[model samples]
Target chain A: MQPGISKKRRAYILLMRILMWLSVALTAGLVLFLVTYVMAKGLPEISWNLLTTKPSYLSGNIGILPDILNTVYIIIAALIFVIPLGAGAAVYLNEYARNKKLVAVIEYAAETLSGIPSIIYGLVGMLFFCSFLDMQTSLLAGALTLVIMNLPTVLRTTQESLKTVPQSYREGAFGLGAGKWRVIRTVVLPGCVDGIITGCILSVGRILGESAALLFTAGFAHAVHGFFEGLNSAGATLTVALYVYAKEQGEFGVAFAIAAILMVLTLLIQLAAMLVGRYFKKRRDL
Target chain B: MCLPMKKRQSKIDPVTGGSDIRPPVLWDSLMKKQAFENFIYGVFLLLGLITVGCVLLITVYLIISGIPAIREIGLFKFLFGKTWASTAKTPQFGILPFILTSIYGTAGAIALGVPIGFLTAVYLAKAAPPKVKAVVSAAVSVLAGIPSVVYGLVGMLVLVPGIRSIFHVPDGASLLAAIVVLAVMILPSIVNVSITALEAVPQEYEDASLALGATPTETYFRVSVPAARSGIAAAVVLGVGRAIGEAMAVMMVSGNVANMPSLFQSVRFLTTAVASEMSYSSGLQRQALFSIALVLYLFILLINAALNFFLKRSKEA
Candidate 1:
């Protein structure tokens, strides 16, 4: 639109701008359609009875309480293992590691772990945890598999927060005659609590949505049990249950109901993550 | 303090320990603390090594379990075979169909996804107003956070039927459907990564271009894009990995048939081949599925290496 611009240059800029706008419109439109369509189709199928009771074969009644419980159990188990392991790894990398080569190797391993897909993790988990370890496709095996899958996420988040904790704090601790472990235990670990919390939320979201990884390591079953018993038993999470209902059982109604729940949960998680991140950022700035 | 106390304990305690027992007690407590510190360090070191140990465990298990089927089937036929019939009376375990389908599907997704993703990223990064950028970025993150099954569900109900009615195909589930689902599914990753890369291009570069009398569009394409080409390349590689490794969504819409890939024909991917049969397969059939998984893993490893190379180059740049 500038007065001195050539006609060809003007046309080129116009074309580029139009193309860019079109692409944005397409992406935004796709998201809008998906969110609305899913909510419309899935909301009607969710009922209180459908949520609280277990599936009954004789009465042809289906409920998702078991899947919900399994999801919670698996998330609890995976987090219990992943947090310490991931935080410890991050601490070693940032705090104690003096060997650059070892740091590079560990960081590279984390990257590779993130790059590998869930299905491969499922396969390997099935082979190692379920079969070789003789865990027999229980929820415990699935949780262990998820612990491996989520370690990188937790490690990266914790590492980022660890970096933000000023070196002066550590130096001050040392100045006060504190040893390395004590300094890390008291000062460094507490500073990264936000990151650990953020990582936990992210991991829970992923665990909630994961199907391919859990399909094998955690077999699809509808039986409900207590937390400890659930870990020792084979049961499906909400995502896997949705898959089984839609694909295997021709129960699109149940599938949509579960999908709606999952969609709501995903939104809530995204919001929580944003809030947590902003809260920590504000606190840190203060 | 501990060092001085240890010296005192060594020299004075041996001579008059009964009278001056405080130094020995202090030395013993200090040694215990040091040992505890060492033990805690060892524990942390072990935790750190667990990641490496996991990587090794996965690699070793895949190799050990994946080799047996390959040895039995012979590598050439297994890799280049034309048919895959895992349950037939005389089974044909050739996975050429799967490999080719996977390649074509990923290529198709990249073909469709990268351009739109690149353009959107460019707009968001360089052209959009702040409010627009914020809204679109939120949408992209929402897309990313939506589970694969939800995408598959939407695709199965909406896309498959739409494809069937529009194209006049007997069935809606086909390679084309899978490609479309994958394209949409990978959009968030491509757009997010490319936006990061494009945003990282120095403001000075664009300012220099504008000062040189070039328009913003030309500057972005000719100068800024070229500057961030490595990052864009990494985004594309990442999209490829996501497309190739996706199982559940593709399985839902691809019809789960092991046929040679045509745009409109039902076909299976390497991932779907492993997943669809995993629950029911047994004996040699099961082992063959593991072999398929191994093949898929190798493909992923290669893609991962390429992604790393591009990412490293971008970081260096």
Candidate 2:
């Protein structure tokens, strides 16, 4: 307590400190409430039947197996297309580009792409992939739209890891008569494997959570199909299914079940990201 | 073997050495290798340009599709018109309600979210012990990772009902509920970015404040916060962008009706307006939806530019 300080100022500071602690407590409490509430409401409804079979109108049964498979298919498809383009862009920007202005423009474009809303992506995706390209609201069009949306995420992560590769390593490889591309393939590419993996996990989490960007691009169909077949046909992932069930069909039970599954997956992704970060840190130290 | 062959070749060259008179086969092979490397470099360059191409494509598509409706509706009526009756006989295309709802919704979310987020960020970054910080931060990340639709679901189940019961409103899906959901939705970005900014404040500034007889809280608020103003501004701006752009969660809770925004009344946001009607809309109505999206896109672009400006200033400072 300073001799010159007033009691009112002391009260003000006390109030702020209390409010800060309260806000932090509120945040933690909200998270706990959401997870527990969704799981408690949803877990009992999830069954082997729900996990394995598609919905049938004749039986009046509702299942999310198709949605789950659709999610997996879209994730796989988007990652397949996104990784090469994203990592290649990152490599070029970090390793090959000499012009500062061009690099800045590319980076700015990536930033702009990321900031655009998912609904906007859905619209443009609907126009370009569905109408113009005549893909017509298939999972493939949805996945392609996500390719553009997640490109910045993958590019950023790969660029960060590429930056961590030592210049000395590149010099050593070149000293051994390796060409530039050979040096990149042997040294730089290997070093960024963790980043690419991390990016994949992050993008998967995003794809799992996405709904607005998929609704128009991937129409809501419940049929389960093979990978190529699914890509060419209309389908709904879990998020979209959740929206459809809760908002359109009034099936809170099915929506809650999907929400619970997504919550668990979200937790897993967060944990994996933390572990991967730690592993990379420890490796760098060693 | 390569050294002996090179030596033999050099001796046989008699008048000129290998450097002056390389074999045509070797020269051709080297030229091909150089060309191949150049081709690979060109491939990578093209890959980099793909991102730029995507941006161009999005911009061009939005503008081309977005212009016709504006041209037909007249920019004034489309932008400032109060009614949004798209399906009625002699349909009206006013989007003032949507625009105002978005503004109010985003403002309301920011008002509610920023204070709590800023305070929580201060506690986490400066006051909390490492273990507590880790746990709380993890909790925040989980909150963030939960999808927007999940937020909408939870809001529909809990917050919507809760508001209905508490306020005795006929339908709890109103601008207030949307604001509440958006506030919670933007919390993670606000907290995470603010924590980074607050932590980046130089330690000596706080230490000096403490040495000058200021309390820790006082030092943080008076000294640390002022130093991190630009970053905090950026965080707020990021929250604004998120709250405005959010569609699914808002659509789920906001009752999806075009109305002049009153806190307790059902209203449509700019995002929900575009999303709700895009599926069934036809002809000029569909074009109007594109025009709505164009407006939203422009808003986002402006926000992005502001974010970049703040981020750059923070880095320089």
Candidate 3:
């Protein structure tokens, strides 16, 4: 449309613009359709019975309480192990590392771990944790596998936050005769709480959505138990249960109900991450 | 001078507790504290190396558990075999079908997904209004966050049936269905990463292009996109990794048949081949499943190296 533009150039520009608009429309339309379709078909199937009890063949009743409990147990166990390890690695890299080669190697390893697929993780977890360690196919074994999967997330977030902490703070602590351990424990660790919390939310979302990694390590059983008992016994989380109910059993109703629950949880986790990130960013600015 | 020295001495006294603490006691406590610090430092160093240890463990275990079956089956047959009937009497364990299906499926997804994702990223980064960009970006994140199983469920219910009716195929669950689902599943990553890359292009370059009488769209495509080409390449490679590694979503729609991967035929990918039979397999079948996983890992390693190369280039640029 510009005065100097030729007919061919104008046609090319017009075609590119149309393509751009069409792509945006298609992408946005797909998201809208998926959310509405899942919600409409899924919300009606959720009920009090589905949330409170276990599935029983005698009465042909289906429930998700056990799966919910198993999911919670795995999340708790994985977090307990991953937090300390991930945070410690971040601290060591930022505050204590003197060898550049070691730092590069550690970073590369983290990247490689993230790139490996969940199915491979499942295979290795089955071989190493369930068989080699003799943990059996239980929630604990699944949780241990997830700890490795999520370590890179926690490390990267904590490292980013660590970089934002001022160097003057560390110098002041040392000036007061504090040792390296004391300085990190008192000054550096506290500053990275927001990052750790954000990482946790993201990891929880990934764990909730995971199925391939859990299928082999955590066998599917619809029994309910206490925390320690649950870790010892094999169980299925919500995602795995959805897969089994839909693919093998052809139980579409139960699968949809579970999908709806996961959708809501994913949205909530995203919102919480955004809020935590904004709150910390504002505080840091001040 | 006497007065200043007296004041300084008083100040030092208050801090040192009037010199009651002898040099040996102070030195001894400092040494203990130093040792304790070293101990804590060592603990952190151990933690840092755990990631390295994990990577080594996965590699070693995959090779150890994944090789016996290959050695037994012959490496050529294992890699290039055309059949995968692990449960059949006198099982045939060639994985050529799986290898081809995975490659074809990933290529299909990339072919369908990248152009759309790239155009959307260009629009978002260069042309869209702030409100539209924010809304679309949030939608994209939601797409990313949705569980892959939900995508599978939707595809199974809607896409498979729709494809069956429209295409008049006997079985709707085929390689085509898997490719469609995967294209949708990979859209978010391509769009999000490309948007980041496009946004990183220096504004001065665009301004110069515009000043030289190029249109805004021309400037974006000609000037900005070239500057961020490496990042965009990295994004496409990342999408390839996701498409190849995906198991459950593809499993639900692809019919899980070990065919040679025609668009309209049921086929099995490497990831699904391991997952579908792991529950009931034993002996050579189980070890062969591990071998399949090892092959998938090699594919991922190659993709990771490519991703790192592009990412490093982008950083330097």
Candidate 4:
């Protein structure tokens, strides 16, 4: 640290710093390398027929149509059941609640829930939503489980974002003699649109990537005729499909295809979220 | 978005600027205000009640479903027993090996994960130029976003085969693969938390350390690691919890074996066993699989509670 320090001492210090950071860099690199290699090796054998067709273990036709159908159904069911509920919860937390202590507790609980492993949610799903509710291995069960799982993260995130709507904007509306509901509808909600979308996209990404909880509660379905009518449906997500294919022999190629799909979906979600965030920032500037 | 800088003057403020303020519709305004307050209170109350109900419903169901299985297996054997198989008549539920695998797997992941994660965070925070920080942080989140299943597949293709070739193992899947992949999977969490923790250490700590003749590198390790231990520990706990509960990826590479973890041998964790066989399982077996999940749930709840406690205490300190 001293200006008068010996050159040898300085050299030794530099060496120590380099070594410390180098080890860390090497580890990260190795991890990334591992992931990238597996993906590349597995990518070659994928074909469109594999996805459009249905899986036939006996016939050797490795199709993913059912898995795709199930994934779509899960998303739709989640949207139908959870969007209104989550939005309602956020509205109450953001606009109605006055007790700071209660607010803090909710916030803390929600944050904890967000950090929890998805598999725990799966366990809870199988128990409460699937068995206790008599909605076993059905789309209803999976959707309900997702509602609970996605609630804390989404509601808290939405509440936080909604709360960020400028108080002055609401006051301005009020000063103009607008009703409370009208002010909230016209100003506060719009202001929080970008933030809510951010939360939605983040949660969506989590949902797409989620496998652990979905495995048991959703059950595995190869195919479905319709998305809406399949209430007592069992299905697999792309992530789950990848898990299924990766484990068994001869389906290694199919596994990589699923992984690629998941990765691309994730990237698209991230890109959209970034775009939304950037748009908000740009709009605010205007 | 911005909060109200100042509370707006309500209609009841009778004397603004010392002028006589008269409101003929005072009762109407007051009633409206009261109603609005009531509505908000009602909503928050409902939400609070629902949140608690959600927590209770899950916890209670886990207990209800798992207890019968535990009673049948006998609680001691369910927790400490090594043989975990279930049938109609004689259901053997031994969770000891899974417990060891989870604990040991998590420990190994931490050992491999923390150092690398902490260093990358340091590099990203301190050494990496500011312009690069933005892209790097996003990349880290991308790492976080990558599904564990994908990581498992990645392990299968890359880690598994690489280990086989490098170490001359019989097959690709092994404990070695889990250790490597889980460590990597948890790296971003570690780095993100560590950077935050390290950044939180007051600038004065560095200045004071420098004044005492310690270089930045020396100060970073000697002083920074201790100061940021709480946050770092929180990160580690989160990472370990993640590793312990991780199923799909671990299941893929773990060979799904229940034996003790040799460096090259693959092992199924409690989560893996549950997830692996849940599709075909029924009756006591299904219940037992859920019981494994229940055990993990309890661990998560406990770990989270402990984490919140530590974070609170750290903030207070």
Question: Total clashing residue pairs per candidate?
Answer: 0, 0, 0, 2
Query: Tens digits of per-residue lDDT for model 1 on B129-203?
Result: 999999999999889999999999998999999999999999999999999999999999999999999989999
Please report how far candidate 1 places residue B1 from its true position, in Å: 14
Q: How far is B185's C-alpha from truth in model 4 (Å)?
A: 1.0
Task: Give Cα distance to truth, residue A171, candidate 4, Å.
Answer: 3.7
lDDT of 3 by residue, B1-317 (tens): 11112356456542355667657776677657655776887899899999999999999999999999999999999999998888888899999999999999999999999999999999999999999998999899999999889999999999999999999999899999999999999999999889989999988999999999999989989999999999999999999999999999999999999999899999999999999999999999999999999999999999999999999999898
In model 1, pairs of residues that clash are: none
For residues A1-286, write the lDDT of model 4, one tens digit per residue: 6797778768877876787668555755664664466557655656788779988879878888888777777877786655555666677667756668877777666666665667778878876778778887876787777778887766766777787788888889989967555666788777777766777787788878888888878876776558666658777778778777767554777888887777777778888988988988888878
What would the per-residue lDDT of candidate 2 be over residues A1-286, giving only the tens digit for each residue? 6677789879988998999999999999999999999999999988899999899999999989999999999999999999999999999999888789999999999999989999999999999999999999899999999999999999999999999999999999988978778888999999998889889889988998999999999989999899999999999999999999999999999899999999999999999999998998899899
* lDDT order of candidates, top first: 2, 3, 1, 4
DockQ of 2: 0.60
lDDT (10s digit) by residue, model 4, range B130-240: 866776677777788888888877777667889999999898688878888889888888889888877888888888998998787777777777888888788888788
> Model 3 over residues A135-217: C-alpha lDDT tens digits?
99999999999999999999999999999999999999988977788788999999899878888998999999999999999
lDDT of 2 at A195: 89
- Give the whole-model CA lDDT for all candidates, comma-separated: 0.92, 0.93, 0.93, 0.75
For B102-221, candidate 2 gives per-residue lDDT tens digits of: 999999999999998999999999999999999999999998899999999999999888889999999999999999999999999999999999999989999999999899889989
| lDDT (Cα) of model 1 | 0.92
The list of candidate 1 runs beyond 4 A from truth reads B1-23
Residue runs of model 3 more than 4 Å from their true location after superposition? B1-22
